[model samples]
Target: MASITASYPWTTAPLIAGAPMRLISGPSLVHAISAAGGIGFLAAGTDVSTLSENLSAFKSLLSTSPIPGAPSDVLPIGVGFILWGADLKLAVKALSELPEPPAAVWLFAPSSSEELGSWANGIRSATKNKSKIWVQASCVADAIEAIKVANPDVFVIQGADAGGHGRYASAGLISLVPELIDAVREYYGNLNGGGDTSSFPSPPKFVAAGGIADERGVNAILALGADGAALGTRFLAAEEAVIRKGYQDAVLKAEDGGNNTIRTDVYDKLRGTIGWPEGYGGRGVINLSYVDAIKGVSFEENEKLYKVAEGAGDKGWEEGNARMTTYAGTAVGLVKKVAKAGDIVRELRGQRI
Candidate 1:
């Protein structure tokens, strides 16, 4: 099996990725990262209503600012989809019509491998194998399951500290990433029939996601046997990200994530954005909403207050009294300021492991 870097030949070694953050990572951010020798994924999360338009925007940018190793037949970028709510038919049709399909497709939060398999099959057929499959696994079990079902080209081992929706009670990457790597090697190593190596699908490359903010974090994941590092929270500070200025300010102001951030469904409940799978919750900076919830505030009262905060606009995220959700990973403290997405990618890339 080739390293994850081998599959993404366009990328510089020590592959850095801007995670496909829903409503945040947009065409410009994705293009910037890809243009800077890293891969970025545009968020399609739960809704591809604007998928075609977004793809067109990305293509437009590519024409004006083309990057190295960009194949004429495929766009050197990726699109992320949250499978639990995404319309599979719409996704397939959107990609099928693209003049140059995205180079990769990231699938996350599927209800089951069966559901993931269906999407994978549809996507491969739509892109005609031009796009590679990237499956996000929250634990070792999900890795084994994806290998059996989707046979993903890349395994994104998402740790507990990741921002946004993720499995609850998951381990940090320090333990999770290496464990998954060992499990994958064992699964494939046992199937190597006298080194013939063709009896089963090639082993997938590992990309560690969660609590990674800088080159040191990237180096740590690389040293753990992962082929790549994918960043979500750090990119929230990127100038090209489609994020509210107030929200971005909150991200810059937060610190001591292990103490300030938490994983819970309170944000989802108050925001009225429920429908995640059972074991999933989001990590975000602690705010009045979380504090009130912890103090046994009734759901009715909390929702009412959240509605008022919603009307407050950007003031909702003021540092002294934050009310809105600031979804981010633990390493958010390391993200000190805003920079261009391309500069952020170039700055975050670490030495090849």
Candidate 2:
């Protein structure tokens, strides 16, 4: 395994990442994380139609609030896309036109390795090979295939405990991280002198994601051979996160670590996001909506309930309405309060709590 700084020679900041959370991780959150010496990715998975508007917001924020220790001209942030749902050509074109161009492009859940490769090629061409490509893999098979085919610069190994959409068959971080590291090492070793293992190409850097909430989790993954740590749920409660008050409150109130969250497609169905690629399901806090769905509530009925609850706005949170989808990870118990994105980054990096 290589150090994140070694793999990404652009910055020497600590290897912590604010995992892209659709509709929640906006420019404000991304900038805050980057300013705190951790890498951040703007979530572009929700609306490609708003690509121009989003880029404008990012540019405005970059100019107004520059990263403290980094150069003011360049935005040390990246953009993430759900490969299966994104318009690859349009996304690449929009990102390439940016004045600074995103430092990287993170892709996940492609329909096929061929599609992933095509997107990688398109992004490299558009950015003149300046933007690093990071791919998320949930299992060893996918990791090996990604390394052999797409050849991304970084691979984020997501465990089953992840908050959002993830492979249905994924393993936990404890077992998955080391397994991936050894698999990649063996793959490279095999390519060099059959078994000598003396000389081999540098394998893609590894980052662990899913269920990692605090500094202890970060240290544990690093000890298991991950070059960095990518946090999603931990940042969902960040003050800059553009999430609903109910969602933030849900995370803070959660007490049942892994038991409270379940991997299911009920919420996706209710929200009409059932088109996600096969073999993927989102892990989120169980609520009345999920329970009702499991008990035979129709999708149309659930959608109606969700709309009414959404219309209630902040009052719904006060009423403890169960219509909302509170996406969270097993580490929800560790997120006790909402803080600034920078402070969250610093705390997770063991700088402060």
Candidate 3:
């Protein structure tokens, strides 16, 4: 079967990648997925101050306790960044100084295609290594534009049902993936004199993201023309994910087959995450805080409630008080338990859960 490993460093076929969930996806999670024959990306988008410490820890872990099934000596891990939220130069500098550079650098939500190219060029010049460049897009226009200007090695097409921040008007994977595939094909066709099949090149590989939680979702997206699948919500409950137990339980309990989640910016606003480029919002499990916000509760009132929840600590999460955010996709219902990260990767890759 065709696989992204052909262009990237992974050895796994039917690639199942772990989405870079900020604060949730850590070195342990990435190592677990990579060791399980799938690729994983470390979330370096937020809290840039900890980048060095995190990268060092990842290098130490890889050096001392190597992941069993990973490709020999290749690190088998990537680092992802929220382009709009991170300083590209500093991020690149930090990664360049790493004892072991990542297998790839994943970028998302760039302000413009030129920014994407600039980041890609910086990494290329800094490392002088063959680390692949992967970019995420939520629509055909952005996908085509990335192909035209940035020419990233991989294009992760995120559907609207995906968890976390994404384009407000994103289309579902079923339609978006095929649309991107056709768009890429057409772009290449146009470049080669309208019909020069001989010169047609296959450069950027496509991976489907958002709401893919199981083997069936993987199979469906692959059949839809994606070379692989990237899952976020499904991994939220993984043992290695750096999430509170309360948040994990919320995902496990929200098994309503996509009916229990809402895509909105209430949590972002409540958390003071302003200046996120327009047309982007997050999909998360519905809770009292969200409901209260939707009910037109004033920010001051909601802030007070949030503080109470925060003060309650783990108890707040355990009681479903909604003090903390539970970012999940429509696939929350499909995740039934907290399993090892490696097991989750295997399960999504068709192994029994």
Candidate 4:
């Protein structure tokens, strides 16, 4: 498989990417990562109404200082969508009409491969294939289906340790990354055309996500055969990240992830954001809300309390007692302090580059 730089010729080596966190990954954060030689995705999760405005803001930032090697025909940043809830019509209009659409589009959480295919096809059509497709796969079946159907330019393998949203039935990166890679290779090696790959579809680059915060994590995934690494929780600690101070502090204070964090639908249910597919769940540092759920607290009561917490503003995110949804991965513990988004990308890329 080709490396990320092989696909996006403008990016730096040992490629790092920022995961699209809704309301958190805004224009400033996206621009910072791209400026630091890593690509960042603006979270257009379910709403495309503001996408054009956001893209315009990014362009405004670039006007003062342009990234070297970035193509004039396409913006260096990416945009992400949660297919199940996204309005497809608006999405197409934004990409098709926005001057110099983003160079990449990261798609996630489609109900089926057909849905994924439709999105991939629509995006390619709208961008005239100038934008590359990046599909996030949480399991082997999803990866294989994405390959056979969408043939995306990049396959983001998200493991169970991921924050925000991920498959409830999933393995960690140690097992999932290599298995998906092998599956892709096997699929290609067994094509009926008899040792002829000249006509075979090219495999997408593999980028591992989940529980990765530093150089050691990057080295581990590269050893497992990933082209690069993408981080969600680590970036949540970035100064550019549009997160509340209390939520950011919670991430910094979290430790011993195995003991302090959990993956469950309780957080979603309490927050009244509940329409995920059957096998998906969110991981976050355990708090009173989850602890009460474990102790037989009714959903009605928990949700009632959550409403009060919502009005608490930043105070709602207090450690050990937070009722606010602090969506984060198990690697929340590894993120010790808040730094500039560009600096976070540079630190993760490290001296090895």
Counting clashing residue pairs in each candidate, in order, gives 0, 0, 1, 0
Model 4 lDDT per residue over 68-177, tens place:
77888899899999888788889999999966889999999997788899999999999999899999998888988998878888899998899989888888999999
Please say which candidate is ahead in lDDT: 3 or 4. Answer: 4
TM-score of each: 0.96, 0.93, 0.94, 0.96
Model 4 whole-model lDDT (C-alpha atoms): 0.86
Compose the digit string of candidate 2's lDDT tens values, residues 61-100.
8679766555433458778888888898788778678656
lDDT: which is higher, 2 or 4? 4
RMSD of each: 2.1, 2.1, 2.1, 1.8
Runs with alpha carbons beyond 4 Å of true place in candidate 2: 6-13, 68-74, 195-198, 317-320
| lDDT of model 2 at position 13 | 37
> Which numbered prediction scores highest in lDDT against the true structure?
1
Clashing pairs in 4: none
Clash count for candidate 2 is 0
For model 3, the superposed segments whose C-alpha errors exceed 4 Å read 8-10, 68-74, 196-198, 318-320
Ranking of candidates on TM-score, top first = 1, 4, 3, 2
Tens digit of per-residue lDDT, candidate 1, span 1-353: 55566666778878898899999988999999999889999999999998898989988898898888877888888999999999999999999998789989999999888999998899999999989999999898988988888889888999999988899979999999999988887777776653534345666788899999988898899989899999999999999999988899999999998888999999999888878989999999999999999999999998888888778889989855578899999998998999887777777774332
Model 3 per-residue lDDT tens digits across residues 132-232: 78889898889788877677788899999999899889889989999988888788778878995445555578889987998999999999999889999
Model 2: per-residue Cα lDDT at residue 266: 85
